[model samples]
Target: MSSQSSKQMALVAFMQAGSTSVYAGSWRHPAADLRFLEAGYYADLGRLLELGCFDLMFFDDRLAMPGIYGDSVAEAVRTGARPIKLDLSSVLGVLAGATSRIGLGATYSTTYYAPFHVARTFGTLDHLSRGRAAWNVVTSVNDSEAQNFGADIHLGPEERYDRADDFLQAVTGLWDSWEDDAFILDREGGVFADPSKVHELRYSGTHFNVRGPLTVPRTPQGRPVVMQAGSSGRGRDFAARWAELIFTGDPGLEVARAHYADQKKRIAELGRDPQSVKMCPMAYVVVGESEAQAQEREGVFLNDLVDPMASLTLLSELMNYDFSAHGLDDVVTDELIASTTGIRGLVQNLRSHIGGTVRIRDLAGHRATLLQGPRFVGTPKQVADQMEEWFTSDACDGFTLAATHFPGAFDDVVRMVVPELQRRGLFRKEYTGNTLRDHLGLTRPEPSKPSERGDDV
Candidate 1:
């Protein structure tokens, strides 16, 4: 494991194959590119992040559009609020062909797809990308996503995590079926592979029963890197057991520090090296030549660009509840918290942020216009300074940069902030390794023997 003093901070570009990335109103920005369906759009962005020496470029995905608000998709379609989304797996192929060194990752839900399908797709991707592949594992949250998969409603958190645990075990087991030395191309000897080296995975679990081995061979990095972004208690526990990289969001520096420390402790308690698991918080940055200019840009995003109704619609979808009927000044009460089938952690965090009671209007603005996570809006030097403070203070191993505008938001960080970070000796100026595991300084896990396979479940 690398020591904190010697470790260079890692950076990942948060992206989505949609009209906008994370900022709800970004699609309307004059500089934002709306041709998301074109492969060339992603190819250009992938190369830019690689030029910046980022560890990875991750794409956040959802199976369905935001239609939970008022049980209608009208607001989402009208505002273009995450209504147009492309498949992440397909986008990964374009990125792989475009960049040589940067890690390419995409989200795939455990709840919607079969374990065998997920294992094979990512395994093939790792080989195609020459080991620069990562999988962001997630359990589908919204009811619309559940309906898309023929389920009437999304599973409860406890049931969802239980199924996810079994799903991962089956997937990893299949990945380990073929040893690294299983292939032996002895064409003259009339031999294609060593049958003895390839083993069948007879995995039987509560949620999945997958038989035999995955058709895909051992990839360049042995397997693709496993990334998770669960923030609930069950989510954190799942991450402790399986995730090599974890993503989270916190409103303040102190809260981020506490969450970081807690997650590290949990990983340590699970008998794993805390340093082996990197915890990254989402950071929204707006950089300019001067602090004043950056503030002005942020003001424009908040006041002029952001649409309050669109923001509320997005929040409603995320929380799995409808807030359209509530009055703007209505205070969230204890009964509402207890009755919500939505994300309890998110509600609790919002409650704490607003002193035990939250107004519907405030919550809407907080989630929509303002940055929901740790934010740094200033000159390049100031942005670097805040990142350095968080990095050195153990608040996070690094940050996942969320864009407020398409290439412009990323352009500022790569062209301006990255150079400053490199000058300060906090970030890398060039690529050190080819594989995603190598870039993150993680060891390739050894294939589990048949006798040791079932124990993970």
Candidate 2:
């Protein structure tokens, strides 16, 4: 447990606000509750994440239901399969008031929200949390969500990424609008502002044209930690440029390592420091005194409110196809899966386990996809061992903890697993830094370079 052994890391709890029910439908779990929208639930989670010696708690958000059930949205709503989705800013603001230091991160889709709205919401959050905030940037990739937004069809993958590039440019450009000292509290002369210090970002991009001097001043972290979670080819490029933390849903270590290396290389190629962007993978780490006990606990958790058929129905809608048409235990292929069917990214990764060892029903175990990420179940020591192995081998920068249920499941991780990790010196036992960026080891970005245009000398 020496500093010389290997580089240790940070942890962020992956919360979906309420009962995330990672499997599919664990809303029925005796311990699981659907009251995250009730406010108090997330306030408790915020405090719990900070108590665990964790750096932050990030709420993962998605715009629409999954695609495999069919083209219609009735299945997810009627079955109460991921029935409710909450507003990120509203929930995070509540959590901010509950915890003093733990960072709060939330997903905001670039493809849907306007840049000015994105700028104001997160900018305010960074101030409210005193710089302990991160923004998870995403592109809406589903038809149900598009329909909700008044679109006839979803944007093509490349177009979505393209729009995302323009969107982030406008948003970040807006974020840098005011220098830290733009607002002066000088009341003696009745002059409270310095107009010269504030500049506008007149950004005209492929999909957007925005002229902005953001209303709010600079945030606590300079700019809230810019985070990205996409892992596709386009995703990597976006993360390379803007993200300080890259949260992923990768399935295996080999693939994860490749992604890590490729991203770091890309960061350097973009003339940015490789260490600035920390790559983290999402995991459902179920720990116990012993491996057997952990597995038993996992089984119990899974048994409480799981319905494989409902999961299949939900999964189909997410991937955008009728996956229930296929047997729950059938082995699927790239040819077989789609975002409308089952997440292609997941089915592709789970493809290896399909032949004999991994059954489709096992994949469908609560309808079979492991939420949007992977799972790691074992004893506390064993989980620590796996974490250390992954860290040393460069599989990821660290881990993001996602619970199958709310407060209770997260509490278990904080109690049993966190201490074990601290004992191993794989994680810090106390808050070493005040700001979320400091804890995450990111430097404050420099203000944008002044423009040199046709009008400028």
Candidate 3:
């Protein structure tokens, strides 16, 4: 048995289907790919992450273009601020065909989609990917997304989580509709499946009522791995009950440590093994041949490449409040914090990071990186050292890496940083298993009978 201290770190590549990753102006970088809509682009990305031995590559998404900045889409379109969006499911399918080991994850909102559709979609993905699929469950945050879904306004956090609870129940029930041995495929017997093994999920809840057996059969892993990235009180509780993997963006190491410990405690309180739930926070790394070189590159990104207006646009969308109305020198106030309907945890994190007070312009640009997570800029050894410190201190199981520029940013890590991590024995040199659960050191869940099935968490 491996000792607790000897556990390997899990790494995931935080990706998107748009022209840029998380950074708004990254697309302007000469090395960044402009043709993100092409299937070959994602295929190359998938293969690269697999080459680096990443546990998974997740595609983050939004349902609508960000128009909350000044309540207009002009700035969003002009700055190329996540304006080009693609269907994540179709992107995942492309990624699935390109890579074999690295897990393919796609973000799907629980708010807009029916439980049956979500279930069938991910279940089909899991089958197509040969047990290497993951679902990044998200509660749609922006009012623009709600508007596209025909809602006059976005639901509050509590109500969203409440509906999400029902959503999870119905989806997992549908996944469990078919047992592992249900398909006999007997040609002589003239039967493709055993009727006795197939079960119906007659689920009725406040938000959804899904009934009957799912169209898809049982997947290779029984069910796709469930990942959640909410950080509020309700979000954490929901994650504790349901998520096998948790994503977060705490700005400081101390805060991340606290969040990690609290989540593990909550998991234990929920009668689940704390070791089973992994906490991976987002990180941006800029690596170079030397520390000074890395610093210079980082300066180019933050100073030259980043468009302050575009950055603020994303921040406004994330906070669900208009920041364009405020003067550049205006202080981020308590009233502003209280008025946001976006994400309470994110607002609180921003407040904590700012401490006393922050100017509108400064907060807008800097918080773009801070709000996403920590940023580490240095040589490969220095970056690896910070990662080791966080991993060893229990701040996180690993990191979900975000790119400052397309292939260049990722290439730097894969070439410079990954070797150092491998030298320290902190990361995998090669994948030992084909399934995503295996890559994460999680045991495959056995199929449960209909009567024996309880909560999916």
The parts of candidate 2 lying over 4 Å away from their true place are 1-6, 65-68, 302-304, 324-331, 337-343, 352-374, 452-457
What lDDT is obtained when candidate 1 is compared to the true structure?
A: 0.85
Clash count (model 1, backbone only): 0
Candidate 2, residues 1-457, lDDT tens digits: the string is 2333546687888777544555555565567766766888788778888898788788777777654365655666665667567888899889888988898899898878999999899999999888898888878656777778898777776788889988988888787777777778788987677876677778888988877778888888888988887666677888898889988776677767877899899999999999878888887787777899889877775665566656766555545567656775666554565334223555544554334555457656624435345567798777777777787888888888777767677888889888888887788889878889888888888767546111111
lDDT of 1 by residue, 1-457 (tens): 1112466888988898989878888987888877788999999999889989999999998899999889999999999888987988889999999999999999999989999999999999999999999999988778988988898888888888899999999988888888888778998998888877777787899999988688998889887999998878888899999999998876677877888888888899999999999888888998989999999998888888888878888888877778887888988777765655556666565566557557888778787765467779899988988888888888999999999988889988999999988887878879989999988999999888857553322
lDDT of 1 at 141: 77
Candidate ordering by TM-score (highest first): 1, 3, 2
* Tens digit of per-residue lDDT, candidate 3, span 236-308: 9999999999999887788899899999999999999989888999989998899999988887887777777
**What's model 2's overall lDDT?**
0.74
Between prediction 1 and prediction 2, the one with superior TM-score is 1
Evaluate residue 147 in candidate 3 and report its C-alpha lDDT on the 0 to 100 scale: 94
TM-score of each: 0.96, 0.91, 0.96
Taken over the whole model, the C-alpha lDDT of each candidate is 0.85, 0.74, 0.86
